[model samples]
Target: MDNNSILLIDPTFDPASASTCNLLVKVGLDSFSYAIINKETKQVNAVFDEQECDNGAQKFAERLKTDSYLKLPYQEVKFAIHTANTIAIPNDLYNEANLESHSQFFTESHSGNLYCQAQNHFGFTTIFTLLRAIDKTLEEFTYAKKYEQNAGLIQLAEKLDGYNLLLDFTVASFNVLFIKNQQVVFQQCYEIENTEEFNYYILLIINQLNINLQETALNLTGIINKGDEKYHCLLKYFSKADFISVDTDLNQEVLDDMPAHYYSSLLALNQCV
Candidate 1:
C-alpha cells in the first residue's frame, strides 16, 4: 500500500467472484478511491481510498499497473472524476451543437473533452470537462462509463427531503450541494486550506442562499469526521449537522473499524446509473 492509502477487503471476498462484480473508481487531482461490489447482492467486497495525491492521473495509471484487484474482470466499470469544470443545464436548454457556449457557465476556463450525462429525473443534463490525460488513462478499462463527481451526490440527494445541504470533502477541498423541496438550489466545489477558510465558505453560503441553518438539514460525507474542526465549525451554525447515512444495503463488515459515513458518497457511486 502507498502512503495515505487505505485498503479494506472483506474476508469472504473471492477473486473468482469478481466476474459478477462492478468496479467503481472515483479519482481527482488530490484523491483516488475504488470499490468492488457484488452485482447480485450489492455487497461491497473491497474498498481503497488514497488522499492528498499530487497527480491523480499518474496515480490512477500506476494503480492500473500494480493493483491486483483492478486487474480482475468485472461485469461493469464506472468512473467518477472530481472536477470543478462542470455545469448542469436544463434538459430543454441543452444542445449538443452549442455545447461550446455552455463553457461560459464554468467558474474557470477549461480545455478538455466535454462529456454529458442526462439526469432526466432532475430535468437537466450535467456537462463536464475531462482532461485528455485522465480520459486517455481511463481507456485501460473495457466499456467503462465515466461521470463527474456530482453524479453520486446528486443520486444521494434524490433520496432526501426538505431543505438539505450535502457536503462531500476531500483533503483540501469540499463540494457543497444545496437542495430545497427536492430540487437542486446550488452546487459548487471550493478549495480550503484551514478551518477559517472553511468557516468563510459556510458564512458565504448562508448569506448567499439566505439559508435558515436552524431549520435546514446538514448532511456530511467523505473525509470529514466527528470532533474535527470542520465538523465543529459546521455545528456552530447548523445544529442539525450529522453524517450522511448509507442508504444502500452494502456489506458493512467490509468497512471494518472505519466510519461508514466517511465513504458514504464513494459507496453511493454504485447507485449512479
Candidate 2:
C-alpha cells in the first residue's frame, strides 16, 4: 500500500458475492475512497482510500480499469463527488424550469452538467454541478447513482438533535454543517491551505451563526486526528469537541488498526438513499 493510501479487506469477503453488495465511492477534491458492503447484512467487506490525488477523476478512471475489486459487478453503485459549485434554494422558490439560471447565480463559471436534488424534509433543493470528466467516468457503471458530498452529511445530520456542528475534513478542504433543534441551519464547503485559514473559517462561522462554542457539540470526522494542529485549533474554542462514530454494522477486525472516525463521512454514504 502507498503511504497515502488505506486498504482494508475482510478475509471472508468473496469477490463472487459482490453481486449482493452495494458499492459506495466518494471522490473528493484531493482524495478518492470506496467501500463495499453487503446489502442485507450491512457488513462492510472492503474499503480503499487514496489521499492527495492529482487529477482525481483520471486517477479513479485508471483504477477502475486496473483494480480488480472495482471491476466487480455490484447490486448498486453510488457516487458522492465533492464540489464547491453548489447552492441551496428554498423549495417554494425553486424553479425547475429555470435551473440553468438559478445555478448560474451561485455556481462559478464551469462547463459542467447541472443537477438538482430535493431535500424535502429541509424544505429546500440543492443545485450542484459535476465535472464532465467525472460524469463520463461514472458512465462505466450501469445505472450508477450520483450525488454531491453534502448529501451524505445531510443524511447523517438528520439523525442528530439539538445544537450540533458537523465537520468533515479532507487534506486541503473541509465540509461544515450546523444543525440546531433537529433542523439544518448552515452548511458549506471550504478549502484551506494552512491552520490559519482553517481557524479563520471556524471563527467566522462562530460569529456568523452566534454559536455558543461551550454549549454546541462539535462532532468531527474524516482526515483529522486528535492532537493534530487542526484538532488542537478546534479545542481552543469548542469545549465539547470530539470525533463522531458512525452508526453502522461493519467488520470491526478490518478496522481494528484504523480510526473508524476517519471513514465516518464515507461510510455514511450508505444512508444516502
Candidate 3:
C-alpha cells in the first residue's frame, strides 16, 4: 500500500512448476506472506511458509517477468543468493536499520567467473562487489579468490562499477565502492554469523575504510531471513541511511492454486520470452 516501498517476491520451487506465478510479500514488521492467485481474480490469497520457496534471489527476480499478476504498479523486484550454513547477518538488524529509498539487485554474473553486478532502479553498473566480508587490510586488498568462487556470482560482481552511482555506497554482504575518482575501487566484503557478528564486521569496515558516516551513506540489505530478531538488528545498526528488501511480483491468477514452493526455478522459463 505504501508507494515508497517496493514489492518483494520469494519463490522456493524448482522454477519449472506450473504456469501459475507463486510469490510471497511482507506486509510489515509482522512478516505476513501473501500470494498472487491470478492476474484477474486476485483471489485465493493466504499466508504461506516463508522458507517453503527454494528460489534464490537470482531465480526469484527472473520469475517476476513471467508471473501473471505479481507486477504491481510500484513493485520493484530483486533477490539474494547464499549457500547453506553461510550466515551473512541477522534479521533484526535488517528490520531496525534506517534505510533510504534507493535500492538495487545483485545477481551472479551471466558472463564470466566469480563476479557480481548491481542493478538499481536506473540501470546496470559495471562494478562487481565481491562478498568477502573477512578480515583484510588495504595493503592486502588485492583481488584474490578467498573462498571457492561461484561462477554465477563472479560474473555478476565484475560488472557493478561501469555505471553511475544512482545514490552512493553500494550495499551487499560488504560495503562496496561503485565508483571512486572515475575508477572502480572494490572494497572489503563484511561477513558475520549473526547480528552481533554483523555489528563487529560493520564496525571493522567503517574503521578500516576510514568511512565517515556523517558524510557517506549507510546502505545495507540482507539475503537471508532466519527470523525477525536478525531483521530487527540490521534495522538498529544502520539506522541512518535507507533499507530496502528484494521480492518477486507474481501474476494474480497463477497464485490462486497455491502451488508448492519447490516450483520456482521451473517457473522462470516465462522470462526467456
Query: Which candidate achieves the best TM-score against the true structure?
Result: 1
Model 1 bad stretches (over 4 Å): 96-98, 107-111
Error of 2 at 133 (Å): 1.1
For residues 225-262, write the lDDT of model 3, one tens digit per residue.
32444445544544444332212354434334442221
Tens-place lDDT per residue, model 1, 17-48, is 98899998888657888999998877889999
Rank all candidate structures by their lDDT, best first, as comma-separated numbers: 1, 2, 3
- TM-scores of the candidates are 0.93, 0.92, 0.30
Please list all clashing residue pairs in model 1, or write none if there are none: none
Which candidate's lDDT is highest? 1
lDDT of 2 by residue, 176-222 (tens): 99988877789988888999999999999999999987769898888
lDDT (0-100) at residue 175 of candidate 2? 91
- Which residue pairs clash within candidate 2? none
| Runs in model 3 lying further than 4 Å from the true structure | 1-184, 187-191, 223-241, 245-273
**Which RMSD does model 1 reach against the true structure?**
1.8
lDDT of 3 at 209: 58
Model 3 TM-score, all chains together: 0.30
